[model samples]
Target: MKKLTSRIDKEKLLLAVAAPLLALVAALVVTALVILATGKNPFPAFNDMLSYGSASDSQVYILNKATTYYLAGIAVAIGFRMNLFNIGVDGQYRLAAFLAAVVGGALSLPGIVQIPVIILVAMLVGAVWSAIAGILKVTRGVSEVISTIMLNAIATAIIAYLLQPERLGQLDEAGTLVSTKPLPESSWFFTLDMGPAGQLWGFIVVAVVVGVAYWFTLGRTRFGFDLRAVGQSESAAAASGANVKKMIVTSMIISGAVAGLVGMPTLLNDSHQFDNSFPLGLGFTGIAIALLGRNHPVGVALAALLWGYLERTTGHFEVIGYDKEILGVIQGVIVLCVVIAYELVRRYGLKRQQQRVGAELAAQAAKTDTEVTA
Candidate 1:
């Protein structure tokens, strides 16, 4: 019986690691097939990407990109852990970052105070944006997915209005670009010198801090347990005295607040202000990374790094006349494959666990039978 339990535990551990890995391998193979159909030699493209992504300068790019992605993934994962899909992360971050940029840019506070003030504003706005959908879901019986999608559209419109030169922004000397006032030097996130290639964004610290906080919040707190319980089953959680509606609203707000930070790495470090060209769609990428990582913080980090590496490799492909769209295809395939693989592995683990328990019971019964016969 003891041996059977040990075996089952080891098998479960193996399955957890093996499932995603096999899925990744399958995704690569499928991507190769797609490239062949396009009449391109996939190997050379793959080689180029791998080589470029491994370069020192490219590593900094990957790190910066991955930092942003990490925050986004955590934002989505917060929703995922609660079985809530907060798709408006894109809108939430965009609006929050813009507002924060405007506020921070206007402020004349010291470096320490200015940075936190900007972050606070972003979080508040992001939470408010997401809370709109959460409120509708809890109060009006609206689906979060639907509400958040609508909110995203609304957020985009609002951002467009706010971004006009006569509104929260001003036209640059070229009159071709619209951006918020540049942030004060005190408020800008300083970069670290990388000796040669360039300076690494200081917001890497922010990413690490957020990641640690996320893990701590989800793993070490009563609220985390309650969130997971609600996710597992609302009916069960309610029976145990958990407030279902409260959890949903709170989860969405938390998700949104984190989503607010998704743009900070770029905003504070590189752009130093919000602009029309500020990145959009990072929220969607976060969802993919969250799914790819199975919503674990560590897994999410790895997935973000992989995704960033792939993205940074695209410049090489574009330079070499290969279509950059192939990377997108691979990313989509990998995400789909990871989900399927996890489900399959979960079922296999369940079956094996049941078999292990049955085998142990049988052995115990046989021993009893021998004792009675003796």
Candidate 2:
């Protein structure tokens, strides 16, 4: 009985990891069925996607995409850890990209000087933008979710206004499109130079550095302890002399600063300009990635890689006469499945914990009775 109980307990703990894996499998099965219904060989289609997704050149593309997603995911995860919802990652990234582009374009210095300056300015811009929502939440009792959403809209408008020729010079002489002047070639990131498989190695380096810094900040720092305490119980944290408000604001700032890093891949690797079309909808997708990864740095990186692989391969489906919209469906299904699985596993764990505690209490009671009788 003891052995069986131990096995069951192990299985319950494994469920946290198993659930997402099962969700991915389930999603693929459903997708295959849908493809078969449409008179297509789902196996060949999937195999083709896999082949392309794993190719050397494709790996580089996916890695670049993963870098952006990972940074954005971390930003959302940081807020999630603090029980704060930062819905303004989109705005934060956009403003950061704009500032970075502006700084890069304006500078005429060496690569070392210009690159760091651009990145720093962008981070500062994003932090300030996100800090607004944090301040509103702390001071006026406004929900971060609502404030962040509204701030996102405001940031969008601000970016649009800044794209004007008078503010930031337009990319084209006519100023028809909403964009900033391109950066000097010296300001761009150095590519891997690994043939067709070459990638933005600088972005990957930055991601690793940021991930390490984030881990240290959250796991080893005094502020991290206070943030965790406040997250677990604000009232208790306050009673214990933790400044809950400061922690909340600090977390938000850090979240935004991390979010700003998302633009480095795009600005330094590809466009080198701030354009309306460049930012995309990465912020929202990042939230799903964060949840799927359980908000852990390693998990988030893996999740981002998976997402990037799917996105890159999905485009190839069109070449093989399949609908690319299937990718969207798959993404949505995966996210839904993962969410359901997480909730189920979480509840199961809670129940198991309760059961274990109850059993321990009963055993203690029996032992006491035995002692008293003897």
Candidate 3:
């Protein structure tokens, strides 16, 4: 009986883990079909992504890209856990990075003080920006999605204004691209040694720390429980004295603070300045990654790597006369399939759990009846 119970427990665990993997497999099948429809062999495309993405140079790229993606995913996940839709991370990070760059360039402090100051400025800006939506939601019942979307527009205008030559920016040496003044070397991040790959972003450490913190806080903290309770049902959480309004505002601020760090990898390591050409759309991409990872920190890490690897290696398709857009198709398919597959498996697991309890109760009743007869 003990062995059977152990086996059943293991089976349950296996099913829980297998659901996402099965979804990924389904996603591949659908992606392959899409590739076929485009008159390209899916195998070669996938092969190129796998092989090239493992190269030293590609590894560096993947690591850096994943770092930023991981941050963005975490930022989005914070709000997701509270059933909040924070659609303004794009604006939040961009505005934060721009302001940080402006401050870092103007200051002449030591690296220790300067870097922290820059980062703190970014977090403060991001938190304030996100708090606007949260405040509106709690006080006036504004939809966060709408408010955030509008905030994005506002942020864009702010960035554009700040980037003006007469404002916080000037043209590059080439007199074409407009960007903020470059920061002093003290504000720049150190790079990790990677031999032929040259170097990897030091901000990768920050990303790891963020992921670990996210996992620990959510899995072990009382605040996390209240946040989740509110997410599951705001009415029930309020009835249980979870302070639903406070959770909403606190979660949004936390989410935005994390979002503020999303651009640090690129800003401190690659560009050393905030430019108009900085990567955009990472905020929206994070939504798919968060969904694909099921909002688990470890899962988000893997999902980030997968996403970055796909992005880094997809150029191989262009080398072989194939369209690079196929990568997007595969990525989208993966997210969709994973969501559906997980839902199905969740329902199945619930049913199996019910069955197990019923059988155990029935066995207990039969044993009692036999003992009574004896």
- Lowest-sum lDDT 10-residue window in model 1: 314-323
Better of 1 and 2 by TM-score: 1
Residue 324 Cα positional deviation in candidate 1, in Å, after optimal superposition: 1.8
What ranking emerges by lDDT with the best candidate at the front?
A: 1, 3, 2
Q: Candidate 3, residues 1-374: lDDT per residue as tens digits? A: 57558867886788868888898899889988888888878898788777898789999989889999999999999999999999989889999999999999999999999999999999999999999999999999999999999999999999998798999998998999998989999889889988999789999999999999999888899998899999999999999889999999999999999999998999899899988789899899888888887788988888999899888888568778788787888788888888889899888877887788788879989999999999
Return the TM-score for candidate 1, rounded to 2 decimals.
Answer: 0.97
Worst 10 residues of 2 by lDDT: 169-178
For all candidates in order, the CA lDDT equals 0.90, 0.86, 0.90
Candidate 3 clashes between residue pairs 3 or more apart in a chain or in different chains: none
Distance from true location, Cα of 319 in model 2, Å: 1.8
Q: Give residue 230's error in model 2 in angstroms.
A: 1.9
In order, what is each prediction's RMSD in angstroms? Answer: 1.2, 2.7, 1.5
Ranking 2 against 3 by lDDT, winner = 3
Tens-digit per-residue lDDT, 1-374, candidate 1: 67887898899889999998989899989999998998889899888887888789999989899999999999999999999998889999999999999998788999999999999899999999999998899999999999988888998898889888888898889999999988998888889999776788989898898889889988999898899999999999999999999999999999999999998888888998888889989999999999988889999999999998988887667679787788789889999899899999999899889987988899899999999999
Selected candidate, larger TM-score, 2 vs 3: 3
